[model samples]
Target: MSVIEKFSLKDSLAIVTGGAGLLGKQHVEALIEAGADVIIFDINENALEETKKYFLKKYNTDVLSLKVDITNEDEILKAKEKIFKHFSKFPNILINNAAIDPKFEKNSAVNKSRLENFDARQWNLEISVGLTGAMLCSKIFGAEMAKNKRGIILNIASDLGVIAPDQRLYKQDGLKDEEQNVKPVTYSVIKHGLIGLTKYIATYWADKGVRCNAFAPGGVFNNHSDEFVNKIAQLIPMKRMANLDEYKASVVFLCSDASSYMNGATLNMDGGRSVW
Candidate 1:
């Protein structure tokens, strides 16, 4: 097959958890562009519907939106059944992209989301969705793929998973490091745990032809304050935060036959942030 043809996910079914979020939406669009039918599994019902409508209208492709709380095993199983019933086959790609990334821009208040003051309840919630949820989805959805003897499991990790979050990037003008709003401990821990899970699943299912890999992406440039954006850009060797679509091509490459030989790999698309 030609190089381009090898990357085509023609007639394949892709399931994307957190399919309505910042990067998740791009994942869905990229998968559809590659000719895969997509199922969007997310907990936010409103965002899920909006994303479903947007993609359906824009791409004019098949998209199944499910209101799934990935932390719940029963919900994952039911969604799995529905997917099998709808497609009449197991999903060829599973994108474990769901995670609780609290928006620092929205909550710029000092001491909020600070590591020292991070609530235990919030910690559990974050881990549940980001880490445990991925595990459940992989166990349920990945099993079907393993049985079929062909599948791709892409875990969405973060650059923070590779290196610690520079609290200075999140520093506000008046607050000290501990008092300032900071990236939660859960985010790094969950992302790191995902990489570990990716390796374990990759090796366990290597003989079954189910390739499991983690995509460690850097910060995407959303509409943050100029101060925050510029601070982050300086930290990256590329001198800019990632554009929302930057990781799409990488996703296509990893999920398709182009990366057939890649397994148990953590592909870092962090634009050199981790290098520093």
Candidate 2:
């Protein structure tokens, strides 16, 4: 195939976890634009319906959306069966994009965000969904890909995966050290663990013609306080948070054959935040 043709995902089927989410929807859009059949696996039934409807009308393509709780192995398997029923071949593109970033109201107790005060239950849930879920999807879906001897597994990591979160960026003036709502430690841990998982899967499936890589993105602008945006932007060399759709093309590149040689690596599109 020619260079431009290598980027085409025609005849490819991609299953994106958290497909109804902000960036998840963007990844689906990118993949569909590249001519790939896409399936969305997310736990939010309402959001899943909305995403399917939006894409159907927008692209005039019947993008499938299944309400899947990735944390549950049974749900993953069932979702897989449903996928198999809908398509002739097993899906070859797996995007491990399901992750939870803790959100709390400003009036809520800020001390809960502190590491010392963080609950184990929250940690377990976050890790299970973010890290464990990815592994399960890869193990089940990728097993079939290995049978075919061709696949791409892309993990959605974060810039914080490369560098620690600057707690100062989340600092509230009146709050004490323990009362500030810093970025939750689980976000960093989950993202960092994803990169490690990417490397592990890449080597494990090397001989099976399966490639794995991580897509690390910096913060995206989604309506935050002006003070917060400026605080984080100053630390990034780009001097601003990314637009919502900015990461779409990069995601397409990583998942397509264009990145055929990029295995066990992280394509960090962080606007120079990790470097700075």
Candidate 3:
């Protein structure tokens, strides 16, 4: 196929978890722009409906939005049934984008997210949403894709997954050492775990025509404090946080035939942060 044709997702069906969030919405748009029928699974009913209406108006593509709790197997199975009812078949692409990454912004009231005083309950909640949720989705949705002997699973990871979290980026002054709102330990753990999950899924389904891969991105600029942005910029060779739309092209490449031969790989598109 020509390189241009390789990028086309005209006949593809993609399901993006957390598809109503900041980055997830962009993933939906990218897939739709590539001519793929898209489905969104997010727990936020309001955001999900809004995303569905907005995208429906903007693109002339089939878009289904479902309110799903990814951590629950029953919910995931129900979602699969709905897919069959609506789209007549299972999706070829599953974007494991749902996560509970607590922001460690300065002055934020983050008492339990700090590792020093982190609550075990909070850990379980984040892990369930970030790691376990992805697993459940993969297990339920991936089986259907395998029956067709073709699929792509893309896990949304972070630059911190490849490298250790630089706690300094989140440090706030005038607080006790215990009160310092460092990057939550759960965030790093979950991201790193996703990369591991990607590898396992890749090998497990290689013979079934499935490709599992991931991408590690640096901070995306979302009106973060100038202090935080500048601090992170210094670590990246590009010297700037990524724009909200920067990941759209990469997602299209990975989810479409463009990355047909690619599996068990993770592209670290982190503005040179991991290398630095």
Better of 1 and 2 by lDDT: 2
lDDT of 1 at 102: 73
Scored by TM-score, the top model is: 2
lDDT of 1 by residue, 1-276 (tens): 999899999978999999999899999999999999999999898999899889879978758999999999999889888987998887989999998867644335546587667779988988999999999999998888889899999999999889999888877686555567778889889999999999999999988889999999998988988998889989999988899999999999999999989999999988899998
lDDT of 2 by residue, 26-45 (tens): 99999999999999999889
How much is the lDDT of residue 223 in candidate 3? 94
Worst 10 residues of 1 by lDDT: 103-112
TM-score of 3: 0.96
RMSD of 1: 1.9
| C-alpha RMSD (angstroms) for model 2 | 1.1
Candidates' lDDT values, in order?
0.90, 0.92, 0.90
